[model samples]
Target: DPTQRGGVILLSVISPEKYYQTSPLTLEACRACLRGIAQLHAAAWENTDLLQKATQQLSKASFHLTVRNPKELATCVESWKGFLQAFEPHMKQAGLWDKPSIHAMGERIAKLAQYISDQMTPSLVEQNDTTTTPQFSPYATLIHGDFKAMNAFLPKKYESACSSSDDNQH
Candidate 1:
């Protein structure tokens, strides 16, 4: 009865006081986050052999979600508002907000996001007939459904780099 089960030894839970120190999450740290998501999607897309699989769905969603221009979108408006609130002080401090380079970069990123959305359509078909199964193979991949701070463990490199304010380098 005292022997280990399945050759496994269970360890006692540690106290919360022994937890690691909390550090701030920054937008600069999210490049790898975005890349990881893209990699997962690419793997799934390749395995499923579906190209614009939900074309009808995307068309409908686009009808409601479409905007004449990227800057006029509600999300962009909210984003710009938050960006101004968050970075206006920093810009004023650095004297870089009024520069053309920053404005051009912002426009470029906005346009790129819009372009990607324009190219992507629905990848799944809604079922109308119970007798028929969708032709496409189901491709599923592991997803970190909740990738918030609680699920994250800092790597040594990230821990060291976090102290530096060179967000641009990330």
Candidate 2:
């Protein structure tokens, strides 16, 4: 069902080949994905206020979904650390990334998140006195917040057949 929040439920027919074997990924597919993501990010960058509103809604949803102590920021950080620790082993096994480099990048992200926590929030009493400059940039456009291999779909047989026909003339 399409919602007022702006999303649609899409349906597609999956081939049996897609179920039994991992499809060979091509460079062209990767490039197309990158292009799509770039376009998404560009759109988000253009709509900073809307993005911020969505972020706030997500943050509230997170609070309702978890039982972590709101007073202890380290608790939240530790949960994230645990997730990375668990995910890294499977990520390595899947040959998705180099283990040590993945660990290093995870650490870097944690450091940045810690820095944001340490600097951004202050006492509620002082909140009204505080003002923040919007952090949107022309570089920050619409981002596909959830991107994965499963989202990709190949063109139909007829489409590929036409492409091959054109290639024979070259």
Candidate 3:
């Protein structure tokens, strides 16, 4: 409670084996990961106001971009161009662009640049072509920009089961 201070703390000690272990790269694990991501997305979407407030507070001391207007879209495209140009020399020096796979990816991305810019145009986003197209529009939402498996934890039940199995093996 907010009013309480120095309350008793309960901690569960995990075995070394369990503590060091991570969920295996398996189909079940993949499904669980996707479910967790969907839950996180839903929660963020539901709490958009709170997320926006937090983001605004953080952005005061840093840089933040929101592409809600044509000018912002143009700015984003220009920024991407600048980034690609700045990194191109380093990428080539690293022999990354020499790889067939990387070259193909780069070609695909180049093809999409114009398409992305066209879609981001304010006129396209504001269009109401309901006769031929479905009535759908996209909006920005908060996302976990640094999501990774290393940052996730297994459910408590799985942890306990793993711990029990480890205990039996010992």
Give the best candidate by lDDT.
1
Model 3: worst 10 consecutive residues (lDDT sum): 59-68
Clash number for every model?
2, 11, 0
Which runs of model 2 end up more than 4 angstroms from their true locations?
1-24, 48-103, 113-142, 154-170
lDDT of 2 by residue, 42-98 (tens): 555546576565444333222221222444444545665576676665565567556
lDDT of each: 0.45, 0.44, 0.44
TM-score of structure candidate 3: 0.36
Mind giving the per-residue lDDT tens digits that candidate 3 earns over 13-107?
65655433354333344456678777865654535354454344322211122322345344654555565577677567666656666545545
lDDT of 2: 0.44
Q: Each candidate's TM vs. the true structure?
A: 0.38, 0.38, 0.36
Candidate 1 error regions (>4 Å): 1-31, 49-75, 89-96, 99-118, 125-156, 163-170
Residue 84 lDDT in candidate 3: 59
